[model samples]
Target chain A: MEPKRSKEASGGSGRPRGRVFAFPPSPQRGVALYLQVADQLRGRIDSGELAPGDQLPPEVELADGFGVSRHTVRQALRHLRDRGYLASRQGKGSTVRDRKRGLQVNPVIGSINDLVQFASETVLKPVSVVEEPAGAEVAELLDLEPERSRVVRINGLRCERDGAVFGYTKVYVPVELAKGLRAETIHSVPIYAQVERNSGIEVAGVEQRISAGGADEELVEHLGLEPHEPVLKISRLYYATGGAPVEFAESFHPPSAFEYVIHLRKGF
Target chain B: MEPKRSKEASGGSGRPRGRVFAFPPSPQRGVALYLQVADQLRGRIDSGELAPGDQLPPEVELADGFGVSRHTVRQALRHLRDRGYLASRQGKGSTVRDRKRGLQVNPVIGSINDLVQFASETVLKPVSVVEEPAGAEVAELLDLEPERSRVVRINGLRCERDGAVFGYTKVYVPVELAKGLRAETIHSVPIYAQVERNSGIEVAGVEQRISAGGADEELVEHLGLEPHEPVLKISRLYYATGGAPVEFAESFHPPSAFEYVIHLRKGF
Candidate 1:
C-alpha cells in the first residue's frame, strides 16, 4: 500500500487531493480501527508483500499512510510482534519476522519422529534415556490396557538454523518399539525411522495438542532465555497402521523462535 | 524444613555480634546459595504447603528465617513470580496465584460454532465475520486441492473474569461449516458440536499450536489491557473419524489473564 502523502503538502490549498489508499478501504464499523490496520498488515505479510527482515515504514509514516494515529500503528505492530510476525530493536525500526514457513501436519500421522522431520529440518541433541511408569495422560494416549504398555523415554533438543533449539522434545515409545536401539541410537538416528527399520511397521496417523507457557529456570537455562520468558508447549501422539498408538511426545519452544503453519482449503 | 535458629542470642551482651549466619547444613557444594533457597520455597509451593492466594512472608523476615540477606529472598521471590507461582502486588505483598490452575485450553477449536460455547465460558464478544479466499496456509489445512478452499473468517474479543478483554481470536471455517449456523449461534452453542449435529460427522481429534505475543490496541481494548501487553497465540486443527480435516482455528490470550496446562507423567 502506498503511504498517504500529506494532503497539505500535495495540494497546498483547501481543495481535496484525489488519492485512494492502494490497500482496501478501511472498514467503517464493527471492528476497531487498529485491528483493521493489523489485519491489513497481516495480510500483506502472509502474501509476501512484506518479506522477513524487511523494515516496516516508520510509525509516523504508517499512521499517515493509513490515515490513523501513530498510536494505532504501534498497536498493530505490537500485535504483529506478539504473533511472531515482527520484531523491534531499541535503535532500529521494527522488522518483519517470518511467521510462516514452518511445520504443517495432520495430527494423526505416522510417528513423532516422522512428524518432527516433516515439520522441519531437524538437528538433534541427545539428553538422556530412561524408563518410568506411564503417567495418567500418557497411558490414555497410548490406549494401554492396564499394565500392557511400557515406554522407553528419550529426551532431546531439536534445532533448526545455527543449532538454535526451536523445540525441546521428550518422546515415549513403547518398549517393543525401542528394541535393538540403545541410548546411543538416539544421537545417531531418528527414533521413528529406527522403529520402522527394526519392527517393519509404518506409522500412519497422529494426534497433538498445543498450549502456551512461561519457561521455568531449567527450561530457561536450556533455551538460553531470561527468566519469565514465554514458550510454546505441544503434545503429540503417533499411531501405526490400523491405529495402534506407537509414540507420545511433548515439546516446548521459545515464542520468538518458531512458527506453526497450516494450509486450509475449501472443502467438505 | 525447620528454620535453623541460633542457639545463643550473641550472649545478650547488647554489643553488635560478628556477622556470622546460623544456617542449616548445605546440601550440595557449588550450587548457588540463592538457588537453594529458591528451591526450598518452590518445594513448599509444589507440595501444597504454601497454598495459592497465601501471602509470602516479608523479604526481611524470610531472609532472617533463612539466615540470608534480604537480596537473596527477593531473588527467590522474583524467580517464583517468573515461573507463574507467585504474583506481587505493591504494598499488599506477594500471593500465590495457582500457576497450574491458571493454564487452560485455548478455546478456538475447529469451527466457528465450536467457539460459541467457549465464548460463553470465556465471555467472547463478536467483532465480525467475513467471507474470504483461503490463503496458502489455510488452504492446505482444509486439504483444498490447489486454490479450492474458500473460507468464512470470524473475529472477536474474549474476556476473562473482572471484565478484562484477555485476548483476540480469528476463526476460519470452511464455507460449508457455516451453512446451518447463523451468527446468533455463536452466543448460544459451540460451533463444533453444531457442525457435528448438522453434518452427522463426529469430531474425533484436534491439533493445536501455541506461542506468546504482545497485545495491540484493539486487542488491548477488547482485553482491557494497556499497549504492549503480552499474550498467547494459538493455532488449531480439527479432524473427523476417517482422518478428514474439518476445521482450522487461531486464537490469542494475554499472559496476565490466561495460562495453558498439561498433565504429564513418566511412561514405563
Candidate 2:
C-alpha cells in the first residue's frame, strides 16, 4: 500500500534507500503513533540499514515521509535518542549510534547426523592436544576417576567456511583412548565419530547443556570478541554402548559467531 | 587416598576447609606439574569454593601442603595470576580474583510439555498489555498485515521462587485472537495456551530460534545484569493446526539465571 504523502515527502529522493520505510500509516490504536514510528526506525538502525554515524533526515522530512505531524516526529526522534540508537546535539540531526550489529551462527543440534552435518560445514583448528589431570567434575562428566585417570584434552577453534571462527572447543577423552589418537584425526573429523570408529562401540546417547556467560580475557582475544562479551556455552557428553561416557566436549560460542535452533511439533 | 604431604603441611589447621583440594597429587604426566596444580586450584576458584577476595595460603605452606617445591608453588601462583584468577602483588599472598561465578537456568525445550513445565515452575509479572501497531517483521511472524493489524502486546517478567527475576518476556497475538484477552489471564497463564483455549485451534507446531546478544540499558536495569551482559535470546512462533500463525513470543534469558538442556538418544 502506498504511503499517503504529506505533500512534501514525495519531493525528496536524496535519502538513502530503505532508510525511510513508507508503508501506509498505521491506524492509531491506543499506543501513541510516535511509538510505532520510533520502533520502525529503530529496527532499521538495529539491522544495520542505517550504519554507525549515519545521520537521520531532518525532522520535517521524517515527519513528511512517515505522514505524521512534525511534533510526533520530534517525539519519535527523542525516544530513539534516549534509547541510544541515535546521537543528537544542537543543530546536528540524530546520527545512528555506533552499536555493533549482533553476530550469530545457526547450528542444528538434535542428533548424531546433525553433528556430522555441523562438522562437515565447519573446520576444526586444533590448538593443543595434551594429557591433563581431570578434576572431579571433568572425571564425572567423562566417566573417569580423578586419581587414576589423566584425560587427553583437545582444545581448538571451529571455523566457518571463510575462516571466521565459530567457537572455541574443548574435547576430552580418557588417556587409554588417546594413546594412538592423532591430532590430525581430531581436526579432520568429528571426535565422537572418530571415537566410535576407533573403539567399535556405537555412541548410545548425547547429553547437551547449553548456557550463557562472558568470555574471559584470553578467550575474548582468541574469539575476537569484545572483552566481557557474553557467549553461548554448550557442552555435550557422548555415551558408549552401555552408558559409559566416552567423550566430553564443551564449546564457547561468541554470539556473533554461533546460535542454535530447535523445532518441535506439539503432537510429538 | 591421602594426599602425600610434607611434614610442614601437617601443622596447618588454620586454612579454610575445601580450599586446599587434597586429591592425591596427580601422577606427573606430560604436562607440567605446576600446570596441573594451577588447573586444580583454578577449578576451585572457578567453582567458587575459593571465593572472590579469598587469600591463598603462604608459599612455603602451599608448597608443603601440595608436597611440592616452593618454586613450583610460586610458578603455579604466577600462572594463576597471569590467567587473572589470582591477584598478586609485591608482598601479600595471592588472592582469588573478584570473578563473579557464572549463573544459568536449565530449561528443557524440545516439546510443548516442556513449555508447560517451564511456566508452572516460574511466575510472570506483567508490565503492560496493550494493542500496538505491528511492524512488518512482527506482522509476518504473527500472520498479520502492517496496515490493517495491531497486535496485542503482552510484556512481562518470568520470576523464579524467592522472587529472583528469570527473564524479560514479550508475547504478541493477532488483534483478532486478542479480543477480550485479560491482563490477569495473560499473567497467570502461558499466552500460547490461552490462545489454544480461546481460539479452539490446536497448536500444531512450535518453531524456535535461539540466538545471543548483550542486553540493552533498559533490559540490564530490568534484569539486574551487569552493563553489557550477554543474554540468550529465544523466540518462538506458535502455529495453528492448519499452519496459521497465532502467537509470537520472545524471551531474553540472563545466563546467570537460565540455561537449556537437551538429551538425544542414538538409534532413534
Candidate 3:
C-alpha cells in the first residue's frame, strides 16, 4: 500500500493541522507497528520537519493521523520520551524537547604513559589520607592477605580547573610503596610518576575493569549528582615487575565525566 | 586518645546491648572518622563477628562504643546502607543484610575469536529485524552519511541457556552486509562468525567503548531490573579491511550481566 499522508500534509483539507505529515505503513518493515511510528516521528524530528518546541498533536489526533490506535500512538510517544526526545504531562500533552548535550570525556589509553597524560588533564586532590588494614575488597584487588596487609589509602576527587568535582577516586597503595603518594601531590603530575619518583617502583603492567552502577550517597555528595544517576566505575590495578600489584585505584565517574574508548585488532 | 568503651561492652552495665563491639580510634589513620567507623563496622561484618540478620546496637550505644557522636554513628550506618551492607528504617533500627551474590560475566577479549567465545556463552535472540534509514546515532556509529545510508537493525536480548534475559542488544548492519544476520540465527554462534561465514566479509578491526547508563523503562521490562538500577553499556564497531565500519552493535547490560576485564602491557 502507498504511504499514507495526513490531511494537513496533502493540503487537500482545511487549514493545515499543525505539522501532521506522511508516515510509513504500519508493519511495512520487520519492526513492530508502534516502533515504525516512533521511527517515523524520530526521522521527522531529525529532518527538522517537526522542530523543537513544537507541541505534538493530541494522542487522539496522532492516532488518526498515523492511521493507528491511540494505544499505538501512546507507545510511540513514550518511546520517544524515554529516549530523551519528547516530554509530556497528564493534561498538558506532549512537546518536542530541546536536547541538551552533556559532558563526555574519552580517555583512550593503551599504556602507562597514556594514562599519565589523562591524569594530567585533571587533578586528583587528596581529600583524606589514612593507613588502614586492608578490607576484603581492597585486599582482593591488590592481591594481599586481608589480615596481614596494610595499605595507605588516598581518597580524592578528580577536579576540573575551576575546582568542580566530577569523579570520586580512591587509590590503595601497599604501605611499602606508599610513600611517594604520601607527600603533597603536584596537582598536575600523574600518580605513577609521583610513585616512581618517590619510591623507585616502576609499573610494568595494568589490569583494568570497567563497569557501571548507581551513585550512592557518598558519591552524590562528592560529585554533586542527583540521586540514582548512572556512574561509570573503573577499577585499575598497577603491577610492578614480577607481577605484584603495587597500587589499586578505582574511580567513580558520573555521566558527565566518563567515556572510555579503545581499539582491538584482529591480529597482532 | 584511647578508644572509648561502651558501658555494656565494658561489662560494667546492667544488660548486654544487642552487639556493641569496640571500634578503632577515630581518625587514627588518614581516613575520615565516619569512614573509619564505616570501615571498622564493615570489617566486623566481614569477619562474621556480626552476622547477617543481626540487628546493630542502638545509635547511642554505638556512639559510646566508637567514642564518636550519635551523628557520626548515623553517618556510618547510612554509608553502610548505601553500599548494600545494611538495611534500616526510622524506628526499625538497622540490620546486617544478607548480601546476595549476583551473576557476573567477565569477557576478556583480545581478538575476534575471544569475542566469538564470549558470544558462544550466551545467545542473542532477535526480537525485531527492521530495514530502515539509519538514525543519527546509528549513522555516527557506522560513520555513514545519515540521509543516504540504510541499515538493517537487529534488536535482541542476550539470554542464558535456560532462556533468562540478562542484556538488551541492538546491532545495526549496513544493508549490504546484513544478509548473514537475517538468516535463522543459530543462537550458539557469534554474530561475527555468522556474518563472515555467510557474507565472506571478515572483521579486520574492532572499536569498543564501555560506559554506564540508567535502565530506562524499556530496558527494565527487557532485563527484569528494578527501577533506577545501574547498567553497564558496551558499544562495538566492526570494520572490514581498510577500516570502513561493517557493523555497529551496542548492548545494555545490567550489573547482574556485565563485567569486562582487559589487560594492558607496557610493551607489545
Candidate 4:
C-alpha cells in the first residue's frame, strides 16, 4: 500500500523527497532485497506519485534510506529499466520513462477475420506456406470431420496505409477452397478477396477473439521490432453466406503502432 | 539474415552456442557490456533456440565464449535472472525458465460493452468509477454534440471460468444511459445489461479492434504478474439494437491466459 505513497508524495515535492524510505521495510523473505525495493518503487510510479522523467534518489542515498547496499539498489534500478519504466544514464541518475504512452487496452469479441476486410488499404508480405492437419480448435471452427481438414497455412505480414506492420497474419484456408490459388497471389491482394474470387464463396458472418502476446523472432524480423516486444494477436473466422466456416486466420501487431477504434451509437 | 542463421544453426544442434564476437573487445558501452550480451541471449531465447530449461555453459566458459570478463557474464546472468527468464545458483550454472508455456497474444477490439450480453457467464470486479467529459474518440463513438457529452468511466477486472483474470476492462457509458445504475452493480452483472434493464435499450451490433502491450504495475498486480509482463489490449464499441453507440470500453489481459478463436468459411 505504501509503495505507491512515496511516488505520490514525490510528485508534489519534485525533488526526491526525504521520505523515500517512509514505508516500513518488511522482513526480507528470501526474495532479493532490491526486488522488494523495485516493487515499492513501481507501485509509486503506477499511482502517479512519481511522474515520468522524475529522477530517483541517488543510489547511495537510496541504499542508506532503505538500509540496503548500493548493489541492491542497482539491482532494483536495473529491473525497472528492463521493464521500460526507468532509464539510466552515467552522469544523471535513473529517471522514470513515459510508461503510459504505450498502454493499450481493448475488449475481445470472437475473432479477427470479421474485421480484416474493413481496412481501406491492406498489403500482405508472404513468409511461408505449408499444409497441416487442423488443430482441434481449427477443426471445430471449420466444421470439418476430425482429422479430415487439410489447410494451406499461409504466413505473411500485413501493413496499413503508413506501411507499418499492423499485423503478422497467418491465414488457413481449407485446401479444397484454395484449389487453384498459388501462394504468390497472396502478396498482391487481400487473401480473403482472393479466396472469394477463386472459390466463388461469399464471406458472410464471422467470429473473432482478441488477446495480447510477445513478438516471436519471425514476427520481430518481419515487423521490424525487437524480440519480445508486446504485440496484438488477432484470430479470425470467416463464414460463407450460408454460415459455413471458410477460413481461419491469426494476426499480430506491435502495441505502440496502432489502436483499434469502433463507433457505436445509442439505440432508439 | 545472419542472425536467423545463427539462431537456426544453434537451435538445430542442441548444444549451447556462444556469440560470434569480433576480435579485440571494444570499449565497454557505459551501460555495461554484459547487458548488451544479455540482450542478444534474450533474443535467442525468444526465438526458441535457447529453450526453457536449457543450460548455459559455465559463467567462465560463457565469458570466454563471448570474449568478455567473467564478471561481465555474471552481470548478464544476473539481468536474465531478474527477468524470470533464467535461474542461477552459486555452484550451478544458469538455466532458462519455461516462459513459452504461458505466453499469450492480445487482439484488437476496444470495449467490453459489446460483450455485455454474451451468453458466456460474466464476472466483474469494480475498482473505481469517475465522471469525465468525452474525449475525441469517445465522443465520436457516442455521436455526442461536442460539449454536451458526459460519460461515466467505470474501471474493473473481468474473469471467465476458473478464476483466470482474463481481462481488466474499463467501460465508458454516456451519463444519460448510466443513470440509476450504481457503481456497485458493476461487480455483479454486466453494466450494459443493467443499463438496458433500467433504461429499456437493447444492444445489437458491436465493433472492436485488438492490440498488444506490456503489463504495467497496476496490471501486474491485478493479474498477479511481474512488471512488464506481455498482455493483450482490446478496444471496443457497443451498439444498440438500432446500431447506435451506447458505450465504449477497453480491456487488458495476460496473453498466456486466454486464446481468441475465430472460424471463417467461404461465402457463396
Candidate 5:
C-alpha cells in the first residue's frame, strides 16, 4: 500500500503530496521556531518520510510552509548539519544524511589474551603523562585516599594505521608505582604489558564497568565528533595478585569508530 | 586558584562574573536560539559557574540577560532537563542537577558460570512477544535474509526486587528454532536456557557487541528515562553448538541502573 499523506500535506485532496511537501509546518507556538521545524524534519527522517539522499524542500518553500523566515529554515538546517543529520552543498539543496554512516572497527576482546592481541593490533599514541591528585571516584576505584593520594595520569589515543583515533584512554597509576615509567615508552606498548615489565608485578585480574555517554568537549576535540554524539565509556580497575587495585582506566569510544566484541560461553 | 571567567562574561572588568550573569545570549544567528542558550548553560555548568542544587536565575532574569523571550529560556531549560542536567520542581524554580546522578551496578561476568549466576540474580519481566520480519541489522547479525526471514521477538525488562528497571533486552529467535518458547516460560527462565531446553541444542557461544546511544522514544517510554538520556547498547549473537547463529539479542541499559562488568585474568 502506498504511504498515506497527512491531510494538511494533501490539502484535503486524496492525491499524493508532492516530494517537496509533507507536514504543513505550524506557527512558532511556544517552541523555538527553528526547533519546531527541526523536530518535524527529524521526525520525518526518522519515520522514513524523508529518506537518505532525499532533498529537503527549498528554504523559501519551507519558510512559506512553516510561516517563518528563510533565516529560521537556515537555522534549522544548520542545527541538523551540526548533529550529523543533513548535508548541504553549494548549489544543491540540503539532503538527508545516512545517520548511521561511519567507519566500522570490530575488535574482539573477551579474554586477557584477546585484549593483548587487540592492543597489539592498534597503535598507541601517547598524548600526555602527568602526576595529579586522584578525584573521589578515581581514588575509590584505585583504592587510594582521595585528597592525599597522587596518581600518574597517562592519556593516550588508540588508533589504527590511518591515524584516525577510535578511542582515548586515561590510565591512572598510583604515584608510587609509576616511578620509572615514561610517556615515550607507553607509545610502543600497552599499559598492562608496560606495568608488568617495569614493576615485575603480574596483573592477576581486572574489573571493568561499561556504560554510555554523549561526547563532551574533550571527546569532541580528540575524536573529531559532532556535538552530542554518543560514545561508549569503559572504566576498568586492574587489581594485583592480592586484590589490590593498581590501575584505574577510563576509555571513551565513538559509536561508529569502534565495536567491542565479547564472546560468552555456557558452562556445565 | 580561582577560575578565570571568559572575557565576555567578565565584561572587561577583569573580575569573574557572578552566577546570576554569565554568557550573554546572542540572537538566533544561524543557530537555534535554544541550542545556543543550552550550550552556554551547559558550559557554565561544566565550568562550575553554576554548581549542583543551584537554582537558575528566574526566567525573567534569564530572558533579560539572554535577550531572548521566556519561552526560549523554557525551551533551553527543557533541553537541559531532557539531557539529565536540570531538575524543575513544582513550586520552586529549575535547579542544576548533579550530572553524575544515579545508582551504579557493577556485576562481574567472567566465566559461563558467572553469566548464569548473574541471570539468576535478576528477575526478568517479559513485556511483549511477537513474530516479525527481520530487519537489515538483525538479519546481518543473525545470518538470515533481510525482509524475508521471520523471527520471534521478545521484549523484556530486567528489574531488581524493588521493581526498578535497570535494562531492557530484545531477544530475537529465528522462526525455525523458536518452536515452543512462550512469553510465560520466558518470564521465569533466561532465553539461552530456554532455547537449549526447547530445541535440544546447546548454545556453544555468544558474540556480543557493545556500544552507546541516546535513549530514543521507545527506550524513553519503556525505561522511564528522560529524553536523550544515554544508554548502553549491547548486541549478542548466540551460536548453536554447530556454530550457526540462532538467536540475536539487543539490550539497552540506563547508565545509572546498570553496569556491565567483565573480569579478565592473565594467562601463562
Candidate 6:
C-alpha cells in the first residue's frame, strides 16, 4: 500500500539496480516510517547489495521509491549515519561504509546445573581424569584437609555444533565421592548431578567468581585462542545442603565464543 | 591460635629479620592447612615485607618458621604461583610477582531501577539535556510514532567514590512523559522512576541487551579509557504494566570500572 504522493519526487532515476525497499508512507503510523526505511536500508547493506563506498540514489529517488516524503528519506539517512553505517559528503550524497558486526556469542548465564542443561545443545568431550593428592589449593577450595585428602581431577572440553571447543573445564571432586562417578558418564551428565548421585548430597548453593584474564599458553592451545587474548575465567564452588563445600571447578571461555547473560527481576 | 609444633620443624636459620607467620599444624582439621599457610604468605606479600623479586625464604626455612612440614609449604607456594602473585624459578626459588588485580567494580546486575539505586552510593553528573523530535530509531526503540513523537535526551556520567566516571549513559523518554522530568532531579532519580512518579505508570518489565564493544573516542574521553579498551554496552527498554514501552537507555561501562554480576538459582 503506497502513500499517495502529491507529486512524484522529482529529478531522479527511480531504479536502484537490485530490489529496493517498498516503504509506503502511512501518515497515521507517523513514528515508525523512517525507522522501517532505515531497517530496510540496513538489510540491503548487510546483504551486500549496497556495497561499501556505493553512493545511495539521490534523495528524490529514495523518496519516490519508498513513496515517503523527502523529509522522511532525509531522516532515515541521518539515522543510518549516526549508527556508523553511512558516510555523507557534500557532493557525494550518502555512501555505505563498513558496518560494525554485533557480538556473536550470547550465552545464558545461570546456575551450575545450567551447564548440564546446555549439554542437551552442546557436546562434552573428556580429555583426562586422574586422582591426585589434594594439595593446599584444592583442599582449601573444596574444604578438604590437605595432607591426607585426595581429589579426582577431571579435565574436559565443551564443544559446540561445529566441533569447536568453547571452554576448557577442570573439575575437582573428593576422591571418596569420585569413585562412584564413572568417567564415561562425565560427558552426558552435569558434574553437580553426578556429585549428588554418587555422594547422596544435595547441592544447596553455588558460588561463582567471574573475571577476565589474559589467556595462558595452555588455554591458547586448548581453545585455539591467540596468546594473551582476553578470556572469561570462572571459578565455581559447590556447597552441600548443610553448607559443606563439595566441589571446585574452573573454566576458561573465549570471549568470541561465549557471553553470559542474566535476567534480573525487580526486588527479588 | 597457633598449633603446637612437633620439634619446631628442624631447620637452619630461625631469624629472617621480619615477622614471619605463626602456623599451627592442625592434623585434626585435615583440609585447610596449606591454604592457611598460603594466606599468611599472601598477606606478607601484600604487606610489602616480601617485595617483588625478593626471594621467599627457602622452603626448609619457611617450614621451620611456620612449624609446618615442607610438603605443606610447597603446596602453599604452588598455590601462590597459580594465582600470578608469585613465580617459581627452577634454581632461583620462588619470587614475588606483580599480581593481577581482579575487577574493581562488581555491580549487582538488576533492573533499570538499580541504576537509580546506585545513585545512593555514587553521584551522577549531567552533561547535556535537550528535547528533540524523536527520530525513527528512537521512536522504534521507545515504541512511539516518529512524526508526532518527541524525546527528552539526557547524557551523563556515572562516577564512583574516587571521582572517576565509570560509565556514560544516554536516556531517552517520550516528550509527553518527559515533560514531568526535571533536569535537576535526573541525577538523583532514574528516568523511569521519575516517569512513573509523574505519569502514574508502574513499570512491569524491562528488556536489556548487553554486549562488548571497543571504546570509541567519546568513551575514551569520558571514561579516561585507553584506546581500544573493551567496554560493556547495555541497552535497556523499560515497559509499563500493559507492556507499553516507556524508556530507552544506553550505557557504556569500562571493563575495569564495572563488572555486571547476576546470581541464578536452580530451575528458575
Interface RMSD for each candidate model? 13.2, 13.2, 12.3, 14.4, 12.6, 11.7
Q: Once model 3 is optimally superposed onto the true structure by TM-score, how far is the C-alpha of residue B12 displaced, in angstroms?
A: 73
Q: lDDT tens digits, residues A20-130, model 4? A: 563354434555567777887887897788888688888988877766667767878877765557766666677776553221211222123324444424677788888
| Residue range A208-243, candidate 5, lDDT tens digits | 678888888878888888777788998887878756
lDDT of 4 by residue, B33-115 (tens): 66666876787788888898788878777777776667777877776654446767667778887643211122221223224
RMSD in angstroms, all models?
A: 29.8, 29.9, 29.9, 24.3, 26.6, 28.5
The digit string of per-residue lDDT tens for model 2 on B1-268 reads 4644343332221222223544354434555667766877887886677987688888887777666667767878877653446756446667776432222111112445556666865777888888889989999887788858899888888786447787998888988887657777766677778777787878877777777778887677788777778888888888887888989998888866776656555522
- What does TM-score give for chain A of every model? 0.56, 0.58, 0.56, 0.53, 0.58, 0.56
State the weakest 10-residue window (summed lDDT) of model 1 chain A. A10-19
TM-score of only chain B in every candidate structure = 0.51, 0.58, 0.56, 0.51, 0.58, 0.56
True contacts kept of each: 0.09, 0.67, 0.69, 0.47, 0.70, 0.09
TM-score for chain A as predicted in candidate 5: 0.58
Complex DockQ per candidate: 0.05, 0.24, 0.25, 0.17, 0.25, 0.05
Whole-model alpha-carbon lDDT for candidate 6: 0.68
Off by over 4 Å in 1: A1-101, A105-120, A145-149, A182-188, B1-124, B127-210, B213-232, B235-250, B253-268
What is the DockQ score, from 0 to 1, of model 6? 0.05
Mark the 10 consecutive residues where model 5 chain B has the least summed lDDT: B101-110
What is the lDDT, from 0 to 100, of the residue B7 in candidate 5? 38
Using lDDT, give the best candidate's number.
Answer: 5
Please give each candidate's TM-score.
0.41, 0.58, 0.56, 0.45, 0.58, 0.51
Give the TM-score (vs. native) of candidate 2. 0.58
Clashes of 3: 3
Tell me the spans in candidate 3 whose CA falls farther than 4 Å from its real position: A1-107, A145-149, A160-165, B1-109, B145-149, B160-165
- In model 2, residue pairs whose N, Cα or C atoms come closer than 3 Å (at least 3 residues apart or on different chains), thus clashing, are A103-A256, A105-A257, A105-A258, A105-A259, B103-B256, B104-B256, B105-B257, B105-B258, B105-B259
As for lDDT, the candidate ahead, 1 or 6, is 6
- Number of the candidate with higher DockQ, 3 or 4: 3
- Estimate every model's Cα lDDT from 0 to 1: 0.62, 0.70, 0.71, 0.65, 0.72, 0.68
Q: Give the runs in model 4 whose Cα sits over 4 Å from its true position.
A: A1-120, A131-150, A200-204, A241-244, A266-268, B1-123, B128-154, B159-165, B171-184, B189-209, B236-249, B255-268
lDDT of 3 by residue, B5-106 (tens): 454322221222333555533234335567767888888897799898788988888888776668767878877764557766456678886543222111
